[model samples]
Target: MRTNKQVYRSGPAATKFAQAVKVGDALYVSGQVGMDESGHIPADLAAQMQLAYVNLEQVLAQFDASMAHIVDEVFFVTDMQDFMSDAAAIYAARQAVYGAEPAVCHSLLGVSALALPALKIEIKCVACVAHESESHRAKASR
Candidate 1:
């Protein structure tokens, strides 16, 4: 049986779209941008990238998942020149959350623009729901 799940983040910055939809063990997170709970985008690329990941992390938390559970990521950027540094920032952010898991699959795309004028990066992720063992839930709670 398929279970339809919905996560609503109570914030003006969050999207009305379901942050993730789960079918059995698989979870699909929506595209996340570099905006905070108040819908303000950061001024610089590095800050924006950090914000984007933060938003993703919040959504993942709702599913009892972390960046460690993420199997795939799609990174959209406004410019290729910003790629390397921006990628490094993302890596750093991931490391902070996931602690060097080799489970990441990624695709980077250079796009003309994103939805918001101040947004320079958008990230989408796919994660698998961890089995809800007592220990797993404990870890997720941490």
Candidate 2:
């Protein structure tokens, strides 16, 4: 069976689409932007990247998953050159969360603009529910 859910915060505008859907063991996360729970974008690229990842984390957490469960990621940025540092920072953060495996399937794209003016980065991810046999899940429980 499949399940769908919309994620939102108190003061933020309602999400335009479903934040995540779970089909069997996999979770598909919708595109997440660099905005806070109140929908305000941060000023710097690094901050925006952090915020975007934070949003992604929130969605994943709903499924009892974390970045360690992420098997794929799609990243979008307005200016590739200007955002490389921020991208690297996000990558580092992912390394901390997922160790090495979650870095494998990643795509980066240069986009004209995001849905919001202040959003410089957006990210989407796909993750699996932690199986009892998974090593990562064992580690997380410790």
Candidate 3:
């Protein structure tokens, strides 16, 4: 079997990892952190979580995909205690981006540390998209 591989870079100063990769119909997004184009990493858990999703959005858009195209996601949080206490608002902000689309499969994990100590959360997702005209978002809504 043959597979096509593609890579995405957030910046010229980016790390040695592709933000997102497209192989056939699956788009594998790397763990997006709270940082943005301006090197901003929010200290607040909710803000960090929101920014992480935003980062995910930027990477996904490169492949003509959006959060709506996401089928599954795994979130790595540095502090489970803090996240569990403020889960509601964080989830709400995340939903604001995904909108009213059907729920995407999700998992929350507690980790000792992330790429940065200031980084509270990192999000990664797998999006199954169409090879042709229709996309994952268009197909899932039907």
Candidate 4:
């Protein structure tokens, strides 16, 4: 028996958690908070959301994956009321990176609190390796 499970670390969170993982052709990214390169959460929800999504995209790229490969995404926001105000901006940020990629299963959750009060948003994702099926089939044929 064998398994394919690899852990990856990136950015300021290298010590916090393996930012991403690959298990049997599936990529699971841990929740990413909205923090800047200097590890500070911005004061605005829109800013925070943009940073969080950017962090997710950059890390995914390191693994040869992109938002287009994403199958599931869970977004956590601090205030549903306030989130509404910046939703358009946040959406724009995501679009800037993802472009016209097919929509992935998504959930927007309003939470009373996040990892920190200053952190306005967090994003977690599960994606399929674009080559997963082909790799699995090739391995089986060998």
RMSD per candidate (Å) reads: 4.7, 6.5, 5.9, 5.4
Model 3: per-residue Cα lDDT over 4-80, one tens digit each: 56656556435777777777788899898888778888779888877887778777777777777899999999889
Report the Cα lDDT for residue 81, model 1: 85
How many residue pairs clash (N, CA or C atoms closer than 3 angstroms) in each of the candidate models, in the order given? 0, 0, 0, 0
Query: What lDDT does the true structure give each of the candidates?
Result: 0.74, 0.72, 0.78, 0.78
Q: Which tens-of-lDDT digit does each residue in 58-92 have in candidate 4? A: 76775677788889999888788888877777777
RMSD of 1: 4.7
The candidate that wins on TM-score is: 3
lDDT (Cα, 0-100) at 135 in candidate 1: 39
Better of 1 and 4 by TM-score: 4
Instruction: Name the lDDT of candidate 2.
Output: 0.72
Question: What tens-digit string does per-residue lDDT give for candidate 2 at 17-132?
Answer: 56776666777788888888666888887778777888887777766778888888888888888877555676777566565646548899999999878888888888876442
Answer with 2 or 3, whichever has the higher lDDT: 3
Off by over 4 Å in 4: 11-16, 132-142
Pairs in steric clash, model 1: none
Give me the runs in candidate 2 sitting further than 4 Å from their true place.
1-15, 85-90, 97-101, 130-142
- Cα lDDT tens digits for candidate 1, 1-142: 6565544343554466566766557778888888887778888787787788888878777767788788988888897786675567657765675667447888889999998777888988888875543433443356
